[model samples]
Target: MAQQQRATETKEALINAAAVVFGRQGYRATTLRDITREAAVTQGALYFHFDSKQELAEEIIRRQHTMSSGAGASFLASTESGLSSIVRLSGELAAQVLTQPVVRAGLRLSTESADDLAGAAAAPYRDWIGACRILLERAAAVGETREGLDLDAAAELVISSFTGAQFVSAALTGSEDLLERLERMWPVLLEGFVRDPDHPVLSSTSDLIYQSADRVA
Candidate 1:
């Protein structure tokens, strides 16, 4: 039992360390030695947990998706409406991109090695989209989303837009700016998609941006 616990801890440490290094150096540029060194584990220990760098990378991708989905579930749990839930979730995701180096690295490494990481990266995103679609459909049934809105398409658009925005913001201005931008854009974007006519809309981007900025400040 003790051995199992130590092994689990070591594996998690390696995955996290690999995520950071892979994010910084990308998959092709990163080596197992780099991951082992980062994890403070011996090469034999790394190999004991993962047979190869490819395997390690895949595990990192899997863990990233799991962590992201968990966050999504948590954010969704907090909101009653689908559109609002998505907006809140987007804010949460953006905050993660800025604050979580492992996540940032996972996103970067996955994109950079799309050809190699296709299976590992794409499956999680598809699952996320599917989950969002289900959430949107439920929201529509409850009068949260606009009537006649194609749930699957709407969910895809929201996920794609936020992903693109996060990538651009992370690359150009950093995660903080990305979160700020998402907060500013969320209400405006939600106004068009939300079905609730009585849903309170913050009139200006400044309102949301400043509110978030104040929290971060």
Candidate 2:
């Protein structure tokens, strides 16, 4: 039991360290030696768990998707209003991307291909789109969302818009401003999805979003 626990801890430390290094320098420029050094582990230990750099990158992407998708599934069903639920979930996801090196690295690596791990990188996006589609379907069923809106198209648009917004934020502020960016994004998205532009929920959420911005200011 003790040995197993130690091994688990070692792997966690290694992955966490590798995530930071990978986030700082993309997969193409990063090496397994760098990961081992960042992890403060021996090459033999790293090789024991991961045979190569591509394997490590793939695992990082897989774990990131697992964690994030689990959160999306868990939270998407808890609220009665699917639109509000998705907006709130986006906030939570923005927080995760800003704070978790593994998520950030996995996402960054997915965008910039260092190897043939495109499938690993694409998995999260596909899962997220599916999740968004489900949420929007629920919202439409409740008559809260736009009539005749294509759920798949709406989901894809949201995913792409948020990615662009997050990329711009990271470029300007080193990712410290993701929450603010997301808050700003909510108003635009709410307007796009809601059946009535003057819905009470939209006003309330917009108020909260701006209030946060003012506080930040």
- Identify the leading candidate in terms of TM-score: 2
- Candidate 2 lDDT tens digits, 10-73: 8998899888988888888899899999989999999888899888988988888886787687
lDDT values, one for every candidate: 0.72, 0.79
Give a tens-digit lDDT track for model 1, residues 1-217: 9999999999989988998888777899998889889999999899888989888888877767776788777645654556555655665555566667667777776667888878887887787788788678767877877778887787787777777777777667655478666765666666767776566533433453444334433
User: Which ranges of candidate 2 are over 4 A from the true structure?
Assistant: 206-217
Candidate 2: Cα lDDT at 151: 90
Stretches of candidate 1 exceeding 4 Å from the true structure:
1-6, 75-79, 195-198, 201-217
TM-score of 2: 0.88
Error of 2 at 216 (Å): 18
**Total residue pair clashes for candidate 2:** 0
| TM-scores, all models, native as reference | 0.80, 0.88
Candidate 1, residue 113: Cα displacement in angstroms equals 2.4
Distance from true location, Cα of 212 in model 2, Å? 13
